[model samples]
Target: MNRSAAEKEYEVNYYEIDYNEKLLITGLVNYFGDIATRHFENVGGSLTYSKEKGMAWVLYKWNIDINRYPKYGQKIKVRTNAYSFRKFYGYRTFEAFDEKDNIIARANSIWLLIDTNKRRILRIGEDMYKIFGLTKKDNKPLFIKKVKLPEKFSIEKSFNVRYSDIDTNRHVNNVKYIDWILETIPLDIILKYTIKHINITYEKEALYGEKIKIFTELKKQDEEGYISLHKIVDEKGKELSVIEAIWGIEEK
Candidate 1:
């Protein structure tokens, strides 16, 4: 079954917004994930089918840019497409648009299909490509700069993985990592700036009941904006994920 991109519409709920009444980044990510799953199901890769086959697609990296945060009660449309596939990787794009059809946020991501039973990445066969309607493309890199860890972190905090943080996959959901990273950011930056860009690379997974530490460094700050780096590590200090964030001055 060949299909183009798929889309879904959603309304920003009151619970999805932050204290400032703007949609939270994690809420937007939920919408993106929902659309991607629905699109895959539309293409015949239903969650049930994948589970029965002991297969699952795991996020490897994220590059998201937000133009402006949508307010509560606003309606937005999300679109996603599986654009390219490599041996063991899939490349996809997602966009969120306002009621006026203007894009408010866009993201590019990399995913790896893995054998759930074996816990290893599986090669993308021709069948997988046909199912997703993916075509080969030139390997122009999707990301310009890689997410880098800070040379030394100034602030660090540790937390135990909560049951609620675990998703259907039996591991902490990707978005939960963002929540952990945000906790270490300076309160001043969180209050005075709005996140405009985010880049995250997943290295490992965290399971329930495990303790994890987040190290954050405010690398740069000026009149225009701020840059923050975060690293999540397991109890043994094993790297789980690294993130870089860019924030712009909040409009007064």
Candidate 2:
């Protein structure tokens, strides 16, 4: 029970930036995921170890807030901490800091440990707890604000999942949903605004070659900016994931 967090430094690269020179959402999430993996590996939780035990971690929910997107070539430090553990869930937090040490973004995520063989959630074991250096159990409820689907979607798009979309988990990677969510937004909105906040809840997995649909609704613009709600479903209309995003004009 010594170390529980890990940190890394990154410089934004051209490939990770969008047309406006701001880091893409996917790129930021990649950094967050990488640090989480590194932290676990540092604490004796390696992929080989998990595979040997037929165990893997899967994301359940995420809530991220950004003060501003990091620009291309900007150097920033990202850190992830394993703060708490419940029976079947792990609670982790992430923060990205600019060169000035200002926290540019913060995120909290929930993950579930799954038995790869049975493909069901597994309760946290004492050994796993020891690996993360966590001893105290968190009794307080961990919550993710519900993302309600709009009654009527203003826009809809469909895509067939591709092999490249699959991660080691054999399903669409969690970050791929962000691309699908953004695809439903209009070009004007994407060009005019930046994602300020995003909340996503995963309900089901999308497999390769499955036809999935995304429905989006743009709510009325308020002082903060625009809010968009999205729902992802399989061809049969089975809900897979729900997302809520807030977009705002970037402050110079």
Candidate 3:
């Protein structure tokens, strides 16, 4: 079977905006996921396993690059397409544009098929391959590099995972983890800065009962005062995820 492309549009909602009155970065990512998931489900694909003994899709990694932030009450069109499949992984690409067709952000993600019962990776089945029309691509997807946090990082805030933080998978959702890490930075810093790139590595799952320690370190790279390093660690001091965010002043 051959894989095909899917695209959808969305209007920025009030609830999706951040305190800065712009679409929340994390919320934007969630919207992309929601639309993409719906597109697959409409075609009889499963984002998570159902009762009939099937597997679900799990995000293995994502590379997101933002050019500009979307404002509240803006209508944005998000285009998504299934590009390829390899063994247990499916590669998808997403592009977001404003009403005028200006590109806001673009992302590429690798998803793994997982067996719900066995908690193991599953190969792409014939049915899904046919439905999604999975095919082979010539070039490899661009992957964000995972940088380790420096040893001199200092803890700025600590947070305990709440029940609300847990997703249907019973683990902290990826976006929420990014939110927690962002909360450690001051508002002034956020308002004046724009995130150019973010790369995160999911090491271990954070359960509801676990407390997360947030640490951050900033450094100047050329003219950009980048938030060079960020990390989340469990109660036992084991790292959960390491994120490196590069930021610069919004271009006039």
Candidate 4:
């Protein structure tokens, strides 16, 4: 694949920014989603397969690194391309850049072709693989570190799903889950810090009207007062997801 290919540009909209006037993390995910969907449409692939078959492309995992966040009025270009494929999964990469072409963020994700009706992973059909033109590569993805739950982590808040939390798939969207977890922290803490890393695992789907309990624990705080630890639990008290968020004071 040519890394120098012209990047696909997208205009920033009012709805895409958060109260802080920067693109929300969820908004960034949606942009990537849009790019992937358009790529499929160009190749004559179906984007609504999940709705038709009761199966959808559920995000199994993702690792995102951002050098800086885009401001509200900035016009950014997001370039995405599929690099490789494995049995039931396809690997893809994306880059978000400013109009001047400075890279702002990059991500690598693992997507599972799922059978929504049966709630199981579906094998990648040969026809689907051919459509995307993906090949096997010798390089491996960055191995995300997993942490074991401490003996005594506790729930901070419990929330019930509102209509707004559900996406077209009738399940909680990946970014919404992140928002929910972040909301558990104090606003003062959120404003004073910058996220250095986040590692999340999607365990199961939480449907509308399900009551979810969010559990969090402070595993450690460094000399600079940066916070890090495990976050988990959903409405049913089941382990819906696990995340490790590292934070540091924003430099002056």
Tens digit of per-residue lDDT, candidate 2, span 1-252: 457889999999999999999999889998998899989899988989989999999999999998988999999999998878988989899999999999999999999999988989999888877898888654344577999776898898999999989988888999999988888888988998989899999999899999999999998686657999999999999999999999999888
Q: Write the per-residue lDDT of candidate 4 for residues 1-252, one digit (tens) a residue.
A: 442122477777788776677776677777877786667656656657546656666777777776666778888999887655677776677889988989887877777778777778988776566667644442245454565556666547778888888876678878887788777876766776656556677777888998887777764475454444555566546788877776764333
Candidate 1 regions exceeding 4 Å error are: 136-141, 250-252
| Candidate 3 weakest lDDT stretch, 10 residues | 135-144
* Alpha carbon lDDT at 62, candidate 3: 72
Q: Give every collision pair in model 1.
A: none
Candidate 4's C-alpha runs over 4 A off are 1-7, 49-54, 136-142, 219-225, 249-252
Candidate RMSDs in Å, in order, are: 1.7, 1.3, 2.5, 3.1
TM-score-better candidate, 1 vs 2: 2
lDDT agreement with native, every candidate: 0.87, 0.90, 0.77, 0.70
Number of clashes found in candidate 1 = 0
Q: Which candidate would rank higher by lDDT, 1 or 2?
A: 2
lDDT of 1 at 100: 99
lDDT of 3 at 35: 72
CA displacement after TM-score superposition, residue 111 of candidate 4 (Å) = 1.0
lDDT of 1 at 170: 82
Candidates 1 and 3, the one with greater TM-score: 1
In model 2, where do residues sit more than 4 Å from their true spots? 138-141
Which lDDT tens digits does candidate 3 get at residues 121-207? 888777777777654442255465658678887647899999988876667888887789788777777877878777777777788
Show the colliding residue pairs in model 4: 50-55, 55-116, 211-235, 212-234, 212-235, 213-234
Candidate with maximal lDDT:
2
